[model samples]
Target chain A: MKKFLAITLVLALVVLGVAAKVKPIKLGAVLPLGDITGRQAANAMKLAVKEINAAGGVLGRPLELIIVDDEMNPSKGAAAIDKLATIDKVDFFIGGMSSGVHLAQIPILKKYQKITVWIGAASHLCEKALAGADWYFHLHPWDYQQGAGYAIGWKQILEKYPQVKFDRVFLAYEEGAFGTASYKAYLAMLEQAKQGEGPYVGLVKEFKGESFKSAAFGGGDYRAVLRLAKEWNPDAFIWAGYDADALPMMAQAKEIGFAPPIFIGAPPGWPADFGKSPLSEGVVLYGMWAPSLNKVSPVAEHFYNAYVKEFGEEPATYFAPLGYTNVYFLVEGIKKAGTLEKEALIKALEQVEYESPLGETLKIAPSAVIKHQGFTTQKILQWQNGKQEVIWPFEVQTAEFIYPFPKWEGR
Target chain B: MKKLGMLIILAVVALGFLFPLYAGPYPLHVMTTVLTYMALGLSWDMMLRTGQLSFGTAGFFGLGSYAALLTTLYLGLNPLASIFVGGVFAAIVAFALGYAILRLREIYFAITTLALAGVFTVVARNLHDFTGGPEGKILPSAIFNGDPTKVYWLTFSVALGSILVSELFQRTRIRFAITAIRNDEITAKSSGIDIFKYLLFVFVITSAIQGVVGGAYAQQYGFVSPESAFSTNFLLLPIAMCLAGGIYSTLGPVIGSVILGVLSEYLKLRFPYGHLIIYGVIIVAIVLFMPHGILGMLKKIAQKTRTEVGGNENEK
Candidate 1:
């Protein structure tokens, strides 16, 4: 009995010593893991951590990713972030895919003063994060850049076709920060082009004052708005919102004859899966980066290929690039910082100017207003035969533009 | 027997008060959420006593969130004081609403309250200018400068107060009155028990306490939206905890909340996608195996042991 006890004790001590050998750098991701977008983000983060660990990890310590489900809801996000910061004592944060979730997480982030990288776009999230602390590092391109880019693409299209003038442009956006900001920026772009010194003039005939409609974020049954939009007889209609509204908008718009000549949406509203629907044909959208373009960079190619190998499928969302790169930005920041200290990490993140997977030098603005929102230069794409094809930034254009949306004929 | 129970209560509270001293931020936050469930379970149990099935915890919770948030924002009151005001505001609304809805019988009452909660969500969504619309309002400052220790104590105090109130009610003559109403409303009415009056009184008090819980929620997390405030989890989780803990008793709710709360956190960790599924399974299991809850089963065992021991002594 004494001999057996001695052997067991020796074995226990060996196990404990071996366990102590590994010092892990804990990282937390707050995402709606149940939802496809969040699940993709979580998978991408896990893949990145695995790769980093295989590459001898960060500062000789293995990177540990702690993922918490936010349920794509604000309260749950705040609670999850609280758990990440307070309970787990995470070294960093790479999360907030939904603007609602990000907005909820802002206060907790400020309280913890942890270095966080953004994966969600609602420019207001940046504004809120910046207002609270200097530790927030946003990677997602803001609504202004994407909205203006879409407007410029529309301008180029209009300038190319002389007779195709957008006499009336109607804007219907969800009342959340992303939609609201993008709508305003697009409106400002129309006004700017009209007022600017350009050979690209006479594209916008008139900007109606009351054309902007702000839909409640969670309101269902959009048939009333469809009726109003059809009656207005708009040459161009802009639908700015998230996927929830966007999915129904496609079905409901086709249900009524509300198809305008020119239709464009902001990033997430144009989900890759939406192309599966026949109603998705001819809908133009803008994004920070698309793997479909593939010409973004070699880093983009590598990330896409790795995701396919790890997950056994193509990433069907634009958020994968943003989610995958957000972790790398944090890892790069940690490398630059050299130490795990909060102040050092914050300073290093602020100074980060790494070439991202999207082939752009990811960096933050100096001010709180647009801090870390420098991932501009979005691509304009249109859906053709259930496949989204890049049609703008002429250098990256894989396909030509399809002008004047055709009406639903005998569908 | 009373002294022993009181001593145990005191001991548990003393441990709870010392929780932050040893715990880190995450455990403290989780415990704070547990306290929230405790208060929710206890408050729901209070209403359940009077044969009233109200599915309007979300309605009152949402109303309290807006009330507290608006009070702090516009009135510029302190968070604690704002929470008090919010609770009172919810109680007032409940009083008025109970005048109409508490007269409902069985499923009608439950359905009405559920519909009322939905109505609160819609009203909060549409009233954008006031309640910050659907996006929710992040308070300019948190209660106690976002101190986890302080937040834990505050939530603990509220939950403790609710549990004591529940125990006190169980001890009082109001218990028999409510029990009579629950057992048979027609018989109780024949015997001069004012059914609506008793129901309204219990509903108002339970709702007032629940409102305080909502106010604490707004102050703690520092934000509340229509969706956040009116999440069905608020309604369902408490009911599940109460039923699983053994309904209509203080001991039942206390045990129920702790087990369900810890189980939920564990399941969330174990299977993030299926936590809701796990929660449903737990409720079903509790209903099937232990219809009377863990406390009821324990009570039965304890009684049996006492009877057998007494019989042994008699035999000797």
Candidate 2:
């Protein structure tokens, strides 16, 4: 009887030990959950974790995601990093949206030196602050990269549609960090164009920029800048501001009858009902991914359907797909590494070619400052029939280019 | 009773000094943030004791941030010395502005000081070459190389210094003059109190404290943007904490900072999505019901208890 009992007790202890060894891999995400971009990104991350767990997780261990809200305050954002690292003891770190918040978090992230895959913070200053930390993988294009991508997209468009003209470009930017940075990027591009050395060479001949206070920052008046742009009479007119300026800027543009050949709104995200507005027709914009990509990419389609069914709302921001990719990409790295060891995992992550829903195979490459940069380009799209139609990157073209922004006289 | 109270105060201070030894990085980080706000709250209340409502906390804080960062970047000054420069610059600016704005009383002065932050932000943004434009500037590394314990001690020392200044104001002749001015400025002037001198002195001192705190914050985070450094949160949150702790006394702002700061973090952890709403409701409820604040309520209870016991003793 004693011999039988001893064998049974040892078996029970072994089973318990194995169960303990199969602990879930924790991913800490710090984001501004109050914002739509952060909100949707978090939701998509949760969905990805759920699906991965349902599929028996990575290496037969479940994945756990712990999210903390940064409140968009720098101090709060830094504290969230500390909580995620020390308190939660998360294995990896992910999620980011604002450049300012990420700037504060960079120090703390460096302290922990955890493997991180961030999906936001497009500011080039963040790139400089990061200072080539190998453990960090940034998936968003830097501000300069985005600017070059726009020049490239325009070049492609001019080639594809000989009828379209964009020699002179006028930029109306908001007087904030984001808008100011965009203006600076354009100025640099113009300098490059003059030297005939960069992507903007032979693309932009005359570029003029004026700054305006965005409505989001309590200054809604865009008439001054718009009137200036109208006076310049550029072939392409673009405004770098917030979503709050989208409809009002359009309405005010129509009021002043200032319609250029290409009317572009380059806000980070648009109003949910923007596409429903009649003024949105033929308005060019730039983004990483759009809902129309669902038709071309089965992965995007599956993500869209599953997300809508799960959350009961459409994923309005590209952050949703990027956030989903943030998880799956890391899981793939883990699978390739076969263990969660830091050196091995970093090496494995360096080689991951994630077929992302962003309509691109995400491969890491050396950027200006960092070693692992993903998605160096954004897409050029236009609002047509209440839908954002991909017009550039011909392989993922959802619709043809809609040139000569329609006159405001008609419906 | 006095000795026991003294013992308690000493014990608390000692514990705070030793906190980093026992606690982890997260709590230390949270406490450091709380200390920053606590110092700001104390400084704000100090200025209020002069019967003047000054909304210049954020302005001076931002000015200090920029001053420290610029000195460090351009002059290659030591980080610690740059913080002193930040305070001195804020005091100089405040002393000059105080001469003009201090003449205006009540809401006019408040409104003018409130515009200081906006004016400073515009200047910082437009001076693209020096201030890095709107994108701001960053340090190569954080202060103390991102050491949580060292960072916490630095912030704790700042808060303690503010507390000492506040205590000095409470315990000295400056308190009587400020009290007289707050009670009736005309009467104070007639009594040979030199109201302008007292008000200017308090303003400069408080502004200096704010600048010092801001400089430390900039160094700790290793960056400063016009938007982040000059954020209205620096003004609004400290004011809220002072109100919640009770106004006028040094202990009020300290107690308020501890309670509201920790409660905010706790609520965030407990309910991430709905925490802000809940935190707002709690603050509103506290301000509405406890008008004088948690400290005031506790003092009232202590006073009533003593009165009840004294009445019973007299009857016996």
Question: Which one is best on lDDT?
Answer: 2
Clashing pairs in 2: none
True contacts kept of each: 0.34, 0.72
What ranges in model 2 sit over 4 Å off?
A1-17
Chain B TM-score against the true chain B, candidate 2: 0.98
- What is the DockQ for all candidates, taken in turn? 0.27, 0.84
Residue pairs that clash (backbone atoms under 3 angstroms), model 1: A86-B26, A87-B26, A364-A372
In model 2 chain A, where is the ten-residue run with the lowest total lDDT? A189-198
Interface Cα RMSD for all candidates? 3.5, 0.7
Per-residue alpha-carbon lDDT of candidate 2 for residues B152-214, written as tens digits (9 for 90 to 100): 999999999999999999999999999999999889989999988999999999999999999
For residue B152, what is the lDDT in candidate 1? Answer: 91
lDDT of each structure?
A: 0.77, 0.94
Put down candidate 1 lDDT per residue, B1-316, tens digits, no spaces: 9999879978988999999999877677778887887888898899888887888887887788778878898788899998887789889999999999988989999899889877887688667668766566777667786787898999999899898889888999889889999999999999998888889888888888888989998887676777678888788888888888899999898898889878877788889878878778878999799999989999999999999999999999
Using Cα atoms with residue i matched to residue i, what is each candidate's TM-score against the true structure?
A: 0.87, 0.98
